[model samples]
Target: MTKALKASGFLGLATMMAVGLHQFVILSGGNPVPPWMIGGHAHLGVLSILAIVMGFAVPALGVTGQLRTAVTVLYIAGQWGIPGIVWLGEGFGLTFLMPTGFLWGLALIASMLIMFYVTITGDGDAGDRGPTATAPADD
Candidate 1:
């Protein structure tokens, strides 16, 4: 979980860099962004950062096993898939990619809801607060 979270953070950083690259592409071409593309780019950038933050929290939040796996898959797919779809659609002229982005968007929301549940309920190894923290008495 820890490793996965950290990797997600790095991926987020990469996404951020890509966002800047996107801006450069526009500027270099001197092309004004169409209204549709603006929202897709903005959402992709923000969600990428959110994924980075969530990656850190996943370990601290202590969600494990299947729940962790499910959330991770859904979150990663949605978070990464949107930008990918947009890139394919806009950059490669794949009009079919737009609908797939919406599906990924749904996955993103599902993952977020699961994350919220884990956070609010505080499930899993509640006592495992790193090496320094003492375990509670079984009695």
Candidate 2:
């Protein structure tokens, strides 16, 4: 799962670079930046970073087997799906694609809630102190 997340992160970064270059070209040609490009760039950059960070944090969450796999897959899908849908819907005038993107958004939200529930409920290895933080020593 860690490797998959890392791989997706790198792939997303690469895609972002291409989008950036495209934007630069458009701007250099004296045209206004399209709203879709801006939206795509923001989603791609932010979600890519989250995916990479979550790669490390997942193991600490104590979720295992199918639950872990489901979360990972859903997150990665949203990381790519949101931006891809934006490009398709707004960039190419495929308005129908826009609504489908909400499905991906829901997937991301679901994954986040699951992890949050696990962490707060002490159901995972994170324990009371949470994943990376340590409790203060007694006086």
Candidate 3:
């Protein structure tokens, strides 16, 4: 793997595991997530998976600004879309106590905005210089 790939790989692995753990937490049926992560388990679970996928794209975004922007759009969509849907669908759920689903939705919206910036400006292994940029330099 190239230096960029190697450097970013740890973040990728962490994100992937984090996503996978989020799923596991949800699937665990109140084991790890407690009462909060229940009910809308799918929403949180999907978000983590999206985060992991986004992490993979982070490295490729090292070159071209356009590809990174595209990744950002997708990231924002996935990040907020699922949570927003869940919050709207189950605003009355117990897990949505206190700040509630609306709060989560708001946070997700904010995150999407931040993601747009990160995707466009952040350097990643995803190689903004087109497909070849992602490929190993020695290859």
Q: Summarize candidate 3's per-residue lDDT along 105-131 as a digit string, tens digits.
A: 665565456556666767653454765
Better structure of 2 and 3 per TM-score: 2
Q: Model-by-model lDDT, in order? A: 0.74, 0.86, 0.50
Judged by TM-score relative to the true structure, which candidate is superior, 1 or 3?
1
Q: What's the C-alpha lDDT at position 4 in model 2? A: 91
What tens-digit string does per-residue lDDT give for candidate 1 at 42-96? 7666777777777767667777888888778888788778877877787668977
Error of 3 at 139 (Å): 18
Give the residue spans of candidate 2 off by over 4 A: 123-139
- Which digits, one per residue and each the tens of the lDDT, describe model 2 over residues 1-139? 8789888998898889888998999999999999999999989999999999878777776777887898899999899999999999999999888998999999899889877876787554453455567778999
CA RMSD for every model? Answer: 6.0, 3.6, 9.3
Please, what is the TM-score per model? 0.72, 0.85, 0.36
- What value of lDDT does candidate 2 attain over all alpha carbons? 0.86
TM-score-sorted candidate list, best first = 2, 1, 3
Output the worst ten-in-a-row residue range by lDDT, candidate 1.
124-133
